[model samples]
Target: MARAPWEGDFPDVFVNCKWKSPDAKIICLADHGLYDAAKGQRDMDAALGLLDDIVLEKTVSKLRGLERQYGVKPKLIAPAAQVSESNNALAIGYANWLGHELGWPVDENIFQMKDFSKDKLNGWVRIAHRSTFYGEIDKKTPYVIVDDVITLGGTLADLRSFILGKGGRVIGMSTIASRDGNDVRIRLDTDTQAKLEKSYGSDLAKFCHELLGFDHRGFTDPEADRVLSCSGYVDLRKKIVRGRNEGDASRSKKQAAR
Candidate 1:
């Protein structure tokens, strides 16, 4: 039998921010764009297909590497429903699909919110006061939280703390897409930080820290500014192309060896 992808080398998961911790890793599958209901569903479905086709094997390989390195697999979790029109039903569906593929149990009842905050203008300090969790999350298990898309990364930051507060160990984070999909390894250098400070001022920068769970996991400027453009969505297509090209090259090399 052909070797499974996971049986090979470890998959590298490059991300802009490390929202959870140094050991807490992330693997983004595809970029999701904002669209109308019908179009959004279609886009999400296509993105989800990538999970079964490309992401699953890669995820398994990555997890195997992590288990070898850390000695365990992190339990998977995804955000519950939003109480507003922005309810992430599609995202929840994607998470369920992912859990099924991974043979992982998903706990959706970890949080119950009176209402999700509407003031996304600041993009940093809005959600902290809005959502709250009630149920008991398993304190013993290490978790790998999944999301459909990471825009400003505020939700991931909040989710990380929520898991930690419940005594859960979040060892990995994953998303199907991000707003700035191409800028995965976005490092904020001294000059970039200075420019952002000049633009949004010190107070908002502090708020960014707060939004990021005060973990200093690192964040992209476009995401911090909440100004990521639609262009980032193209990166998903590019990723698909790259994956296919690499696969073909590998097959060719193997056949030549035969």
Candidate 2:
């Protein structure tokens, strides 16, 4: 598991923005080309780096529509934190292009403040080792988040939380692509929350606070669903604990190699 040089070597810091109501609108231009490519014989390298001018144009076009629909002009565009397998900040390229095309300034201040990588991890492991961000945000400005793709939306949720925590308002998010049937909304619904509480009882909140560094309400819809899918709270705890141990060992090995 290679880590980015810029990724910090510290504890994970989870931010609970309590994002609810008026779900943040997402403008996804296409389905994730990479995943689609993996299913058959297709090349998606250019798409991954936002090097395809057609895709870029399409993304910008949709963003324009979003602007008109929302009637809010974003002062800045910030890319969600994502370090690729080759140690590249993938979303930054897309964000820069979007900013240039949309006449918005690109904000690169928010970034990963931990040495965690999401590549090839299962859902539970990914949730256990969620990325943390650190930086200054312009509190007075309305912002838009940009990312190459949306999976479970944990990354974008964290980015939104960081901006909201810094007193900045994120008007919306624009992604190049998204998984089919995936909802962009991050807030867990009442029904889902009720189910989670029923399964885990009050221990759910304590578990989230102690392990993930947030209250249970901080969970995104997908994250809460994943948690609820566990057989029981003990099973969930064991999985998280094992994931954390594995992560710690990997980081330790990397440090020793350095």
Candidate 3:
């Protein structure tokens, strides 16, 4: 889809203003379906930064194997995002342990400025609630991203964009688990892009630009699929707009109560 007319020559605030193809390799330990028996236990623990011994061991082992397979010895490890409810993030703990095991330093510079926890959000609501990153980055450092889980992969994508924009190089991303068949890569594929354009035309692009400060190309593969699953542009737009409005109202109520 072409760029919206009003989006000329502007930089995206949360991500890299210039679009680039995804190149980082994804290394996930297990599928989210593995926790089906336990239901919300895994997601709850992950959000609260509670790491089980088995989960930790498995994650580190898988990451080590993937590191060898990829033949990439990253200089630094950066964990993606943070939980609003707690200072300790599961990814941060994972990064620290991985750094010690691999003899690399863990970088804790990037910070998430918002709470966009997927567990509490409804369908396509997350599209309007992208997390923003802030903090210093060391230029030219080869960094690997670590996270507790991946769904739409928007958090990792935003983190990658922030690092790349700040001149750091991201070589790989690792997560403890992800939804089955969810590709953790951030860039939307050409085939999917074509489908979206065909279905929604430039209106989709315009809506994305308005909501996300970027176009549909910034969407992760699963996120693009989620949008495509909608009946039409009207339905998609309504979902996004209503979700955003509800989120704002909820946050406002919380603030007022506080």
Candidate 4:
């Protein structure tokens, strides 16, 4: 399996992940822009100004690799942007860079609200950032799902379900960073957290401290952490497990196919 950059090179995950292709749809889950700790995320418009050619070149290389490994190249379509931003200039830059390099037209119109919730979504679900979006997703050909980070993949699950329901297929999912998660804490999602606690009587705090890196395992970003904490979604640890499990399953299927 193509291990993420942080996996320490145990073994690369070999899958049908096309890093190169002439035509493919690309979509960024969450805000595809970088998370700056200091200046914070510049609006998508500001992101355009920061995007140098070097970044574009490297991005092209990654996309080509994805296409070669999978089957198609992804023209970045849409991205989750900062709500404070005026426009999708950064997103447009990302899409156009991929489009021009890969010879595909980027679909700039494909997007959703800045953020989504379980109550707001219908059909399938995929985790974008730590949030969830439920609606039309990958339903036709293989599409590319991108995100700035893949912490636990809870958001990705929502994306997966939404895609399946829409009849679209995903060639592969890509992200800037996919932080590891905790398994014990994984049994602590909002849906299953209470059930497991009532059944197994596990202590959430002690478990996170012992097993996961921090008491709040789901959040790696300080700002995101604050956001999640404020939302009262105290069970972020399990999303990592669910995310990894889903990733494992997806890669396993690809491995089996190969």
The 0-to-1 C-alpha lDDT of every candidate, in the order given, reads 0.46, 0.58, 0.59, 0.38
Q: TM-scores across all candidates?
A: 0.51, 0.70, 0.69, 0.41
* Residue-level lDDT tens digits of model 3 in 127-200: 66766678888785577777656667667777777777777766666664555423254556677788989988
Off by over 4 Å in 2: 1-62, 69-71, 75-86, 181-183
Error of 3 at 128 (Å): 0.3
Judged by lDDT relative to the true structure, which candidate is superior, 1 or 4? 1
Residue pairs in clash, model 1: none
Measured on C-alpha atoms, candidate 3 has an lDDT of: 0.59
Number of the top TM-score candidate: 2
RMSD of candidate 3 to true structure, Å: 9.4
Rank candidates by lDDT, best first.
Answer: 3, 2, 1, 4
Residue pairs whose backbone atoms clash in candidate 2: none
Q: What's every prediction's RMSD, in angstroms?
A: 17.3, 9.9, 9.4, 15.5
Runs of candidate 1 with Cα error greater than 4 angstroms are 1-60, 82-87, 112-114, 117-131, 182-258
| Model 3 pairs in collision | none
> Global lDDT for candidate 1?
0.46
Candidate 4 residue spans exceeding 4 A from truth: 1-45, 53-59, 75-93, 114-140, 176-258
lDDT of 2: 0.58
Of candidates 3 and 1, the better by TM-score: 3
